[model samples]
Target: MKLIFGIGLFLSLSLLCYAQEIYKESMSLMGSDFEITVVSENEQAGAQYIQIAVDEIKRIEKLISSWDQSSQTSEINRNAGIKPIIVDRELYNLIERSIAISKITDGAFDITYASMDKLWKFDGSMTSLPTPEEVSQSVARVGYEKITLNEDEQSVFLKQPQMKIGFGAIGKGYAADKAKEKLMQLGVKGGIINASGDLTVWGSQPSGKAWQVAITNPMDKNHAFTKLPIMHGAVVTSGNYEKRITLEGKTFTHIIDPRTGYPSQGILSVTIFSEKGELADALATSVFVMGIETGIDRINQLPNVECIIVDDSGKIFTSKNIRINNNEN
Candidate 1:
């Protein structure tokens, strides 16, 4: 009777493990749910790895987060235009990358957008369009060139007094990348790090199948546009569907173009596929602001980078090598 009972328990456990389901856990960290999903594995080990990933992500939040009043990034902001503050190596590297991207994009991607005055409100309170003068002045302090970086000392300085830098565009991606690294180091066979909508995945399904991720339709949130098979890389999406303001019959998106000091218009959503989550995250925002034509050109110039763009009229455009799996289930 004891042997029979043990065999029955083992069979029950095997049945439970074979069920096709999304094994997920949510942790309150990095100002949101640091979500992890594994195809099928040891549940205890998965949960432990996710917890460790969340801890690492929150550490990044503390390092690069600008919204947090007590973060080290705040120290840099406080010292802007007054003194240069030496930052951690990680943040120093991220800031350096941001500046480099900004230059590469000709200031289209800027971290100094915090200096813009609250000229355009998308919170359903905007009544009229910002005047030309207001738009020009808003971007006056928004120049990546003014951001000074010292490589040897690992320091950052803002030339203007009111200038400030925020990682809102790339923080989530950075966290996701860091979390992915930690999980890989811990010997996780299969896992995903999803920081909000920015996500990176690795390994394969238990049955040795590639992991597939669905791209949601911005116009119809209930539906997916396509499912992309991801083996070991990252994907990031920037969309204007959730945040927009209508002023004087003109619709403005939440994605602000730093060079023009106005919200980006035309494109509805932009998705970037890259080997590095941080680059994918920042590029998604940059390309969304750059619009379809220029965006595709820019992405094509970069190696191992691809993009999919949906315009306001629902027209879809993709880079040369992007393959869309349209099996909607």
Candidate 2:
């Protein structure tokens, strides 16, 4: 029910490539742990840049957080069936993009999933599986197709009274991307904005090497199975290893399929690589919900995007473009 292992899902395995000091600051933001790191020998400048990143993340949280009744997202949810809620262009664009992603994933990734009531618990509170009828009712109010958006007014409205939306699946990655963009705009050469596990990287290490990302074994998270370099890009890993419940001797992951209203199965972890953290974050969850073959097929069709899937049996699967052992950076 809680978070991380979302993007920077794999243990962040950035190697210290240069002698330049790596200054990092950690904070809890948007109900998740966030670590912002920048490479610079000047301690003062690094601290300032980190603070700037922190501020940007906080700004994003206030704009999109559903937990805060004052946020635009909450407003949209409150006015779900009553009237269209006008929102800032930034949020409108974000929701538009989210819907686009929903179309691509065929409802595997949905923001309207927030309408689902707490039916399954992973904290040992859930001992029995929800009946199929209960599962169906849980997702009755959740559907991307039910969302109505007016481009002219830049407004959002839910078709159902109980319908709601949230960015928990993609918010961290969006925050990471925005923070990285702001830092880069300020002329920060190289650094990492890791929102929980949703991570974005740019520039080069002090040694002039591209940033490298390592994939963790679903069986053994501490041991990375493969490492790939992603410079000026983002990588997000969504794993069911940490949040799951076993009922009737069947293990169910926390990633529930909004379309089916059942917990996701078959895959233990999904890691997506793309130029944007927002897309990576959404795709990771989508692929996890889509299962192995379909997820790999979907990722194969997308350009400049790749994914790694670990199934329940601990089998490793990667997209066509990914070279398992060879260095592709």
Q: Each model's TM-score, in the order given?
A: 0.89, 0.91
Clashes of each: 0, 4
Candidate 2 lDDT over residue span 276-304, tens digit each? 99999999999988889999999999999
Q: Which digits, one per residue and each the tens of the lDDT, describe model 1 over residues 98-211? A: 988887677778889887888978788877788999899888988888999998888899989888898878888888888888878876667788777677989877666888
Q: Candidates' lDDT values, in order? A: 0.83, 0.88
Model 1: lDDT of residue 117: 87
User: Number of the top candidate by lDDT?
Assistant: 2
Clashing pairs for model 2 are: 7-197, 7-198, 8-197, 8-198
Count of clashes in candidate 1: 0
What's model 1's overall lDDT? 0.83
Off by over 4 Å in 1: 1-22, 39-41, 324-329
Candidate RMSDs in order: 4.8, 9.9
